[model samples]
Target: MLYISSNLRSLRSKRNLSQLAVSDAMKFGLDQYKKYEYGKNTPPAESLLVISRFYHISIDLLLTVDLEKVSIGDLVTLENNRIVLPITVDCNGNNLVEVVTQKAKAGYAAGGYTDFSFISELDHISLPWLDKNEKHRVFPLDGDSMPPHNDKSSIIGKYIDKLGDVVDGKTYIIITKNNEMVYKRLNRNGKNTFSLTSDNSFYNSYEINFSDIAEIWEYAGSLEREQFKPETNDINNLTMVIKKIERDMVEIKAKMA
Candidate 1:
């Protein structure tokens, strides 16, 4: 309870809100507000609601120990009397979703050329982001570009944006000049190649042909580990590799159609 009060004060201070201002907005006297913040009394449901409204927070955040506010469907852990909320998909018409993160691509690639047999099976595949009118699939991240943490192989069927034109701020899996697929955050630079960047600092930035891309899918979510291990996982890296190949397959099929 004391912890909650401290958090309230801390949050108010961070947001630059005063208790008196909050109480005035909620129509409460300063003394009553002091009691709530000082742990002298538990806040009433109405007061909680008012605080939630004023702070643009969920009631769960006001009275609970969960400082990281996630969406309704996000995974949450109630441990050590604190809430640990996992970041999750936005249900408010974001039009992206997660799929099976295994076996995104198949067959073999010799040199830089790929056999279409494995790619052929992926054609006409439906993704969670399609949402009836939109046609897209959830592409997963692959290779060392996103490695040292996430395995390229762990996210085979994850989502990526399949919108006609790649928009800024959306993430994508891209194939580089080395014929390697990488899970990169897509930041468009002019009309030529897309800038593929890894979130981790250990990896370097590079460009992709864009034309050689097999497909463009939509991004949805990630499998977050409880702990952040400094070393990257090889299995996860390969999983993303297969996913990028699968995206390339989809791109080829689209060009043919």
Candidate 2:
């Protein structure tokens, strides 16, 4: 409401961060980056946290006030005693896709990239296969557990939530036993154990005591769907390799049970 984006842009300029630099930190390409600063996009709560942390400010500052209008340095203390500073967030979508693909090739996916996907209130997303409606969240599938799904599809697009809001049934992108990344529904059994259920029969469930998870970041919005595509025939080959990797990863996980 306070044109906070203008303040952000001003502070970023003062700090010598070009628009490209900010985009890199946010994992957004130049186009998405421009849209963010221009207020065409609003980041999620997690993203807001990351941005505020980068500026050494509370979320309140970024959400409600503009530091530029008050004749302050990049840093500012609000009436509520919150601090704000200029920060840079940047990333190249194409490069990220390549890196992520390579990670899949290596049979693992690391956690570092933040989710940028979002859903609008007015949007309608329905899945007949799961008998669900109006439940949706854009999740970047990290590995090849769903090779058919990721093939010809960018990892950054919107995914229909067939499992609804039930926390345990919520499908999540998680690390499997053999070190590959995957999307699986999380289930909590009565015994302090959690199950990683995969929809693909080729990949089995990963059941753990729920203590081994390294980190879990919830899904956000869809990446701009049209942004990525593999340029060569290697995509198909990569897909096959990833599918086999995911299968082996799942087998190893099932054995851990």
Candidate 3:
């Protein structure tokens, strides 16, 4: 309830709405609404519901989250007080997506992901095709663990706050607290862990505890940079296999001798 007063004031101020105007919109008495803003009295649950609906924010968020510390975007629907990522837009009102590339992943995992200043300072790009209502980010991947996504190609993901919404066997960008950033297909390993498997069979699957995860972004789309001319060197692959077989035969002969 401590954040309620400041949140009320902050929301109103951001919209440039007068107290009377807000009160009239919510059908709340001006004095009562003023009391709520001034922290003189806490609104009843019903009144809070009215305000919540009017603001299009969850009651839990209104009562708990410090609005001043966060930049609110009406785009993301807040459910059960889940963190609403600050959504920024360009001058033309197109949503600006902040990118977290392979090089900056360590910094991002080291609190830059949650720090407002750090997020704002990162590079941004605008893509109009994505749903404007959802929060999105672009992550450029480099590894061959997930094939078909050309190395260094970028993937756009929608931010999902609740872990419950993470469906099994879906690809996602998982950021762990241990400063690890990886994109892999996921499954429910248990009540508190996620089983991650790479699309490429060369990489082994592993499980990550729920407690270790910092953020999970659902795969939305990709910006795959098509390789103009691919190197087709099957002879090298055959040579390696032949060498491996020759080494195995030599080891067997040595053992027999």
Candidate 4:
């Protein structure tokens, strides 16, 4: 009952290819390929593999998913039993890093990240330091929860496809199911949760369930809106100076004693 005839037809149409053209590329008789589009017959496994390779799509997706409704990013393919990302590349042969601004943050958290139209509408930049093969996205920071990356700044995050790749004590931009987007230093709490901590001690740390995390982007680099000033009146800065002074006085007292 799960026929791939429609899916095949949709993909071909999307690519603006005629049935005859596809059949010629596949080296199959025109009549035989027509049967596949007409829902009278299905392609063999070998033929399916050929089609998948030609279209740069996965066989599982070709057979199971509605290609018309799914975006390229949402498609997952298995190579050697490992999942592969369908990263989009620009015509200039450069990988595009999509920027998630404060205005678009809500849409991204609400599952718009995987929508082709939504993603296309977002502004993109190319980073020379970033590998063309790696998937990346940029997110804007809103609060002073983390120093060095204060309000009006943005962090470029490399897409973390698997949860097991998350490193302890590293910073990440976490997107939650309820649209809670935050940048925090991460620590593994257990198998299913992570301890999220802000650099500023004033904000208490807490644990977040992995199930609530919709997406995770590992911190790669940052862009500051304004020139960084070391003399900012942050409470953490004053606290650190006071603590250093107190430690120095204690050392002097111990030496005298």
Worst 10 residues of 1 by lDDT: 78-87
Estimate the lDDT of model 4.
Answer: 0.77
The most accurate candidate by TM-score is 4
Tens digit per residue, CA lDDT, model 1, 1-257: 22457656766777688889877887999999888878888778778667755665444445544343323322221111112211122333232333323354322111111322333234233344335333233334444455433543333333222323567766665433344455667777666567777865445566665554544444444444434565547996687677877877887999999
Q: Between prediction 1 and prediction 2, which has the larger TM-score?
A: 1
lDDT of each: 0.49, 0.48, 0.77, 0.77
- Each candidate structure's TM-score, on Cα atoms with residue i matched to residue i, is 0.35, 0.32, 0.60, 0.61
lDDT of 2 by residue, 1-257 (tens): 54557756876787799888887886768786677688888777767776776666545446655566444333332222223322211121011111234323233233222222211111223333321211222234544454344533323322221222227776565433334455566787765566777655555676765434432323332333344455438776687578879879887999999
Q: All candidates: CA RMSD in angstroms?
A: 17.9, 15.8, 10.2, 11.8
Q: Which tens-of-lDDT digit does each residue in 108-175 have in candidate 4?
A: 88877545567768898888899765679999988788987787799999978667788999999988
Report the Cα lDDT for residue 181, model 4.
88
Clashes of 4: 0
User: In candidate 4, how many Å is residue 52 off?
Assistant: 11
Instruction: Tell me the lDDT of candidate 3.
Output: 0.77
Best prediction by lDDT: 4
